[model samples]
Target: MNAIEKLQSERQRVVARLAEIDRILGQYEELQRIAESYLASGASHTADSGTVTDSVKTQAEAQREPSVTEPNLPRVKSPKTPMVEFERVVIELLSEAEVPLDRSALYKALLDREIVIGSPDESSDLNTLSARMSRMKDKVVNVSGHGYWPKDRAFLPGGYVPTGVDDMPSQDATSESGLV
Candidate 1:
């Protein structure tokens, strides 16, 4: 067989492996969510009796105090922390890099940093990252020939303007105007 045929065959195998890995990762994430939910709900039972006890109820009752409450007042829950802060991480990485990094390179960098990515409902995927970068036109600029670079380095001494930054006015103007 020709070299092109061999390469195509190899590509097919690699794609299959990637799909399998993705499936396994999905299962792993499901199991992780289940375990976390169980732990968060404080699952406990007697060894011999195998009966569940209400630990939260016991604790709340012990700490309960009498307080005047208005009949019309509504109860509010505290805000939840973010599940993943990937946008900040990417912005920091892109800003710190000396050269522009493509999507694959950025993904590898994130993985090396122990940031779990590519799972469903996660922003670390390339599509999501690209959408975010596109929205953050001021912070990142896409070079014509090169990849994405920090906006500060958009000028290349060739009198060429980056794509999206052209429409966005000066950051100073935006801040002063407070329209951004």
Candidate 2:
């Protein structure tokens, strides 16, 4: 190939690589936003180390097997407590990273910065946070085998123009028939 042809090929390759990098970066940013939203929702609850009080358990049992005249059931108090402060710290870390970070990476980053949320005593806390985000996948982003990415990108949005694919129905062709 001539020098001009060679340079043109190199430029095209560089542009393709840059586009791929941008897509990856975009996925990371979306994940970060999801993590922040989870923390901000105040869903982080701590488990109590102590066993349930005997009186409370007894009362619960009595309510379960009610007499013919009594229909009221005893309300059970949750053993968990909200860790609002810790949640805020985790959210802050996620916001600062502005990228999709695995659980281990996030924990390490927080530790390096001396963030108290993922302290040794609360080693499994980060897992809980991840679980919370995972549960909300449908409403936010689809987090399957590849972690999280915006759903619309995987599936074209309404009136989208698809390119670089095999034979498929054109957007205008479908809409013109009023069949959608």
Candidate 3:
């Protein structure tokens, strides 16, 4: 009924429980060994029948039916095309932005998409993307430092003032005299 007696009683119970668990674990280990031995013997028998496990299709079954499978040929990888990968990405980015984007903005967009530029000449690099975009005059129109946009008028983004239009004098100018 005192603290010392209570502590001793609890310790004894814990020791007994641990001993029971150890006994159970030993039996499990022995069962696992027996299962492995039985499977090993059974596998030799299956090997004698000449097939391994996708539910063990036997040699007899293989011959009694036509094997529809052709022999496993080496896989041939298709050749890569000559198109620059980043060029496509740049087009897509500009299309999504709907505005003409410069190199830095396009670079930032690429970074936002987790694409880091590699080197000066790599397709994903800033210089390479700029060069590639410059060459695509039919596809993209430059807007100075702002960015690039699709060349078609319908695809041109809102708020864009086309060159020379804002600067040109209105064609409606007439002489002040009211002569017909």
Best candidate according to TM-score = 1
lDDT of 3: 0.50
* Per-candidate total of colliding backbone pairs: 0, 0, 6
Q: What are the models' TM-scores?
A: 0.37, 0.26, 0.34
Q: Give the TM-score of candidate 3.
A: 0.34
Model 1 Cα lDDT, one tens digit per residue, 1-180? 999988776666555454444544555554454445446556652343421121113324422433212222222111111123455666778767756787778777865654444445434366765765687676677766667766654334222344567544433221322232
Model 1 misplaced stretches (Cα beyond 4 Å): 1-84, 116-124, 154-180
- Candidate 2, residue 60: Cα displacement in angstroms equals 54
Clashing pairs in 3: 100-147, 100-148, 100-149, 101-147, 101-148, 102-147
Give the per-residue lDDT of model 2 (tens digit) for 105-137: 766665564344432345575766566546544
What order do you get sorting by lDDT, best first?
1, 3, 2
Better of 2 and 3 by lDDT: 3
Query: What does the lDDT read for residue 39 in candidate 2?
Result: 73
